[model samples]
Target: MQQPGYFAEDVLPLLASLPTWPQPSRKGATRDAEWILWVKMRMWNRLKAQFTGIIESDFKEQGLEEEDLAWIAGGLVDAGSATSTANFHNIVLYLAACPDVQATAAKEIAAVVGDDRAPAMSDVSPLPYVWACIEVLHRNTMPPWAIRHFTDADVTHKGFVSPKCPAVVCDTVALQFDEERYPDSFAFRPERYLGHTEFAGDYAAMADAQPRDHWTFGAGWRVCPGTRPAKSNLALMLANILWAFEIRPPTGAEKGGKGSAIDLSDDAFDMYPLRQARPFKAGFCLRLMLQEGLTVEAAF
Candidate 1:
């Protein structure tokens, strides 16, 4: 996991201590499952410690008390890293499977962010196609459910009515795939979002933004606080990746098979509350060497 720049110094040790999952073995599937919870617990403990340290040392002037630390740590891990990792996993899977989309995005990135320098936030304006690809991926792979709201009182929307209820789920899968909203929705077509300047958060904020960009970031007053940084980080990552390498699925020889095919279906993802692509392979060939004077931090 990449540490947030502002807190990198304080959290570097925590990043180093992150747990590694046991490798899958012929007889280890069941055994690995039993220990996965333990690994997750260890990870959370390390993260919580790191967050507390940062809060006490770095943000001491903010006047936050000890009791607030656990809640903040949980939010940082669950609301930030987990979702970003899943999004990135989906991006790589889609790019490897769709060579044409990959090529188009790379071409656009090359035009706007030449090999002389790393991609910067300034390049976002001219790279609509790349953003479109990202939007499509977000729409397709969004969690099956968004934040669940318990009714504070009776309410109705459109034709449906609800009395006080324990939970009301906004079915993300249904909303994203509705044929009226996204024609031929299952196909990975970035063209649908061409000329759209708004990020997912922009759409989420609006009461009625036609051709809603995406719902990966939950909508309304409770929308994620990390949306802006997430968008910038995602753009920079994708731009730098396309600018520096050619992404493709592994060849048949590499897989020890006559032919190789990347699965781009629902079967490719694991059964997780947050959608995550299962481990798969993609090949990256260098296109442009790292430019002079670009630090590792800037390059990423």
Candidate 2:
């Protein structure tokens, strides 16, 4: 059992006494489960040791006296919160603005989830279109650049050589929008991920060989371990939101012939120029929260 909530209440308050600015607010609703798991299972000793010599004795990092545990905790918090917000916001904008995609997802949800109380994690597999939609959102709107990385050793690309030890920024645009990987990368078509219709053969092979789950969660050791929870949150939120409401453009706006296709410019202010849709108003109407186990005759 992943009893992270209990660990947070019992374990975290004691760590603030250490010499770090502060551990981010890791309340029940706002904590990362993996982070808590690591702290509970792996790093419990450091917390128990506090300023004691147990840390100094066991883990000598580059001959340093003690490890900075607070910074580690902060990094986990930083990774989980902001990126999750951006991902969820981007998904909502795409779903609301693209009615075709939204309809497809809703139809899938209706068929699989079926006038349910609410969508659950188990329903994710049955909703592969929903999965593709999420992937498209990631591929289309990942951060303009990835976070900085330090070079471990000298590396050469083609004829040019980057020095052995300078920090380098990844060309996120080139990598994400690689024509070989994502044909017509600019267009928001989830079917490319599903490899259906016109996007058969190479695209399908690419989709299967290595699905572009995107570098937003990052890669390898620095990878965000919160992906499971993040996907769950996104999937459930999208399923329930689309299931419960009909999203429409604001009143008086001329919604081009197919009013569903709205302009999704990132005009909203962000702490670091985030990829968010502009503040366009969407009118949501109350739709039937379909009930399960009640047939037509039974309901009547």
Candidate 3:
């Protein structure tokens, strides 16, 4: 789970660059999915270009004007500098380096996805545990606020007037942690999204009707067009990393700090530029088949 800021700082920029990409002619809502896919592909391509640019920039610092074109021309290398690539890289790096959510994710992956094959986009859909992990990550490290926008027409909230063109801002973190909506709101219980429970019904409805509450992505008509693709990419990255490594707290250390317990409160925002996370440690290792060739590994 790459945290909410990663989407805003990295993924969104790459997605923003993609609208200019050439689109095939199509009519009506018939081609909606195709158009979405086209935009996604364009976003990914632009992200790759941006990542390449970052690599070039880093080389410039070392007195190298350009990356080795031969090496670069090789398709789909894991060079980690561009927007989406960097976002994924940061996530993988954090999972490898951070102790909190990383270990839990690895355990879930090992129990569900296994290591023989890396996770694919399709696999993410059936993996409720993985989805819950993503949700927790978002709740814990989301940006303090969403971008402010003005409504084109007047709106009312609780009988109060929100006059037309009034500036409106949404508090993302507050909404996710609201206890009335999310019971035991501060706890990192992935089960909240699993099984056929009351909240699960709400989750299904939200998945079907309104996805805005999944506010790691924004809202309304201008919401992230890259939401589906970004999620696919995120799921694949998380799954592969979990399948490949084991995460755990460092020896002689507690889950979060020296004699301090893991805090799921809003206070856990220190590691980000906008919010710093308390220092934590974890270890990683390759998982081996434990029984009769049946094993579970994490996927995104």
What TM-score should be assigned to candidate 2? 0.63
In the range 163-260, model 3's lDDT, one tens digit per residue, is 89976776666767778878887665655655422222234345453333346445544453444455556666777767766543343335343222
Model 2, position 140, has a per-residue lDDT of: 45
C-alpha positional error of residue 226 in candidate 3 after TM-score superposition, expressed in Å: 2.7
| Model 2: lDDT of residue 7 | 44
Query: Scored by Cα lDDT, where does model 3 land?
Result: 0.51
Task: Tell me the spans in candidate 2 whose CA falls farther than 4 Å from its real position.
Answer: 1-67, 156-160, 179-181, 195-213, 219-222, 253-261, 265-273, 289-300
lDDT: the better of candidates 1 and 2: 1
TM-score of each: 0.70, 0.63, 0.51
lDDT of 1 by residue, 1-300 (tens): 121242332345454344434322313544665575455555657776555555557554686643345456556566777777787888888887888999999989888878799898889768999878777767754455676778888888797888887677666787778898888889889998896677677777777856577766666566778777776677678888888877667665566732258798889886456677888877666774434322121100
Best by lDDT: 1
Q: Pick the candidate with the highest TM-score.
A: 1
Q: Hey, what RMSD does candidate 2 come out at? A: 12.3
**Every candidate's lDDT:** 0.69, 0.58, 0.51
Candidate 2 lDDT, 76-165, residue by residue in tens: 565667666777766666666687888888888888888756788778767778777776766643455655678788778798788877
Q: What is the lDDT of candidate 2?
A: 0.58
Worst 10 contiguous positions by lDDT, candidate 2? 291-300
